[model samples]
Target: MKGLIVRIAAAVVLGAAIVTGSPGVGMAADATALIRAAFDNWRANSSESTVTMTIHRPGWERHLTMKGWTQGHDKALARFTAPAKDAGNATLKLGKTTLIFNPKLNQVIKLPASMLAQSWMGSDFSYNDLSKAEDILTEYSHKIIGTGHAGGHTVYSIEALPKPGAPVVWGKQQVKVRDDGVLLQETFFDQDMRVVRQMTTDKVGRIGGRDYPVVVTMRPAAKKGQWTRLDTTAARFNVPIPAYVFTRSNLQNPRN
Candidate 1:
């Protein structure tokens, strides 16, 4: 009778463990799904927008205006349209390769991997940052680490760790997204888990029938009194983009 009672107790303990473990697994899966869904929400089939970027430094400030187009995460083009010095400057990304067009030099230079971390057009955003829209979902494993309230909406705080062998620079990334799929903040860390930089939504509003962050800011961790602010002036989603827009020829000679 004693042996039988011990066996029954063991079975009960095992059953309890299984019941408790399943929810934790399910929660993780749900968090990942939410992240992927948020990416899809932000990245439509095609998009076009006009923006103004302000680079703030301790001693100087400058503003740039540009138009941008993107078709999927792999293809994007941006052309500077304001400030005569930067006018006609453009950058194009096709797959893994990136090219920049300089009106002064009349040259289209392909950016190598070594230049990925450099600031784009002296803005706080790097060439790598512009191209990593899809990597947050594909190259990292995500888990919901905590929760908070922002602008009266519940936000999920997610931690993303790069998968083994993934071609990424950050050791980890922390993101906060609202329940309705709006990205509120994203923080990047170095390999040693030191905070490198962060981007945050400064203003949220309706754009192209979707709730989006119309104004965002990027600030490096060590660079006090310096930041770059991007404000969307206009936007259209799921619109038709001309094929030539993504080609090398169009980098300098853009056609309407």
Candidate 2:
């Protein structure tokens, strides 16, 4: 569950990819185009990102910093940079396998594919959700649920329910998309129709001729309990990432 939650927090930095020039594009059309654009862009670029999080739970408050690089849709490598306990720990994915590097143990453990369905720290996202980028429209059927104002921004509300037998983790998901197709917020519901997690993206900007968000925050849906908040401060796209960065063996055997 811890891994799932952590990845969900990581996803808050990733989930939004919009269509560039789809004026009058309905929710469905925009969603389809959004996924295609994200998939195409990720396929052509390698990038680096930095993430910070404040985890709050009963009588506990912790902060975490993570840095990593991503290549295409299937490769990524990230390591914790802060909080003495988690610092130096790493998660690396190369195609289908995910390896976790533990500095204290000086060892790497390969996680089973089936474990992807498990939650990250009892948080909203699943481990499988973190292993690769998702095509929201392609992976789930979206229905224009309604319109709403979220975080003081106008948004088109949509609900994505997975198709029968789909490799989905959430029972239902709500997304708030800006007029331009950027997803500004998302709420995930459990099988009991209760919200499990929520994410909000703020401070949108253009980097390298493409529109993107600079900060994204995620928290738990429940109000009474303490939840974690993750904020992304920097995201760089189309940069050079070492070819071996995302490999499991590379993480296990770091170069001097």
Number of the predicted model whose lDDT against the real structure is largest: 1
Q: Write the per-residue lDDT of candidate 1 for residues 8-73, one digit (tens) a residue.
A: 000000000001112233234356765654443444566677777788999999988877776665
Tell me the tens digit of each residue's lDDT in model 2 across 12-101. Answer: 222222334444553444554543443333222565667676666687777777775667666767667788887787767666676778
**What alpha-carbon RMSD in Å does predicted model 2 have with respect to the real structure?**
4.3
Can you give the TM-score per candidate against the true fold?
Answer: 0.86, 0.76
Considering only N, C-alpha and C atoms within 3 Å, which residue pairs clash in candidate 1?
Answer: none
TM-score of model 1 vs. true structure: 0.86
lDDT of each: 0.65, 0.56
